[model samples]
Target: MTQDELKRLVGQAAADYVKQHVPEGSVIGVGTGSTANCFIDAIAADRARYRGAVSSSEASTERLRGHGIEVFDLNQIDSLPVYVDGADEINALGHMVKGGGGALTREKIVASVAMTFVCVVDASKRVPVLGLFPLPVEVIPMAQASVARALTAMGGTPQARVRADGSPYVTDNGCTILDVRGLQILDPVAFETSVNQIPGVVTVGLFAQRGADLCLMGTTAGVEMTDYRN
Candidate 1:
């Protein structure tokens, strides 16, 4: 199957997982990205089953609204029961390299708030290590250079992420993304904390020790579940 088809299969698996796990009257956390879009589509088809959702990005909020899923700000909700998202890369331990769509900060916030985080992706995204995909770090434009230099010192090649319009890609929170390459990360928690210590660093794409509760990996063999819960 093509990548799109694979993504759809994985997304469907994730949606099914969420539908089975998230109880009625529970507040859900929705993330951004194409795979997450597939989950939203699935959820929308079963609108009456969910209570509401807190979206991680404006784009996701719009889509949720189109599907009749009530969207709320994070502060508006007392607590989130489950947060389902897609990862750019996820390791066996459930650590992920996110923010390919530049919504990492918000996505992380929502995921952190949820009781459980479910990551959905194609099999290609599963890896033994997390840094193969360029790590996305959101930063303030004023400290972009400083942060880039710091990441470089940490053994990464940092590049300012730009838009197809040639402008600096601005995140929903008005931050810039620095795609960092060339680093083989082993200790994700330490790396996350260290990167966040940099001035103007909003949030790095590294989803440290906060492992996913479950992962839905789609492959030619079909959808498979990685249940971290024991």
Candidate 2:
């Protein structure tokens, strides 16, 4: 199947999984990106089934609003019952590499507040280890150079991510992204912490120790569940 076709299958499976697990009247945490868009579309198709949605990006909020799904600000909600998102790359352990869409900071915050984090992805995205995909690090524009130096120290080659218009890619939070290449991450949690500790670093795309509770992996046959909560 083509990439778009595969993404659609996985996205549908993910939406179906959420509909099955999420209880009515619960505040849902919605993630950003193409796959998450699919989930939003599915949920919107059945608007009355959900109470409200907490979006991780402005773009997501607009999409949900367009469907009449009540969108709540993160500060407005104390906690989210579930957070459903897609990853650029995910491993068997549920560790993920995200931020291709520049919403990593918000995605991480929402996932952190959620009771359960559900990752949805196509089979092609599954990897034995993380880091094959360039890791994204959100940094303060003022400290971009310093943060880039720190990433190099960590054995990665850092490059500024740009938009299609050739301008620096700016995130929803108005931060910049440093795409780090090279380096196999052995301990994701430690790496995440280390990167965050750097001055001017907002958040890293490496979701190491804060792994997902469940995974909805789409395969050629259909979607398969990988339950890690047990």
Identify the leading candidate in terms of TM-score: 1
TM-score of each: 0.97, 0.96
The parts of candidate 2 lying over 4 Å away from their true place are none
lDDT of 2 by residue, 120-186 (tens): 8888889887888999999999999999999999999999999889988988888999999996887
User: Where does candidate 1 stray beyond 4 Å?
Assistant: none
Query: In model 1, what are the clashing residue pairs, if there are any?
Result: none
lDDT of 1 at 135: 96
Q: Show the lowest summed lDDT stretch of 10 residues, model 1.
A: 10-19
In candidate 2, list every pair of residues with a backbone clash.
none
lDDT of 1 by residue, 145-173 (tens): 99999999999999999999998899999
lDDT of 1 at 210: 74
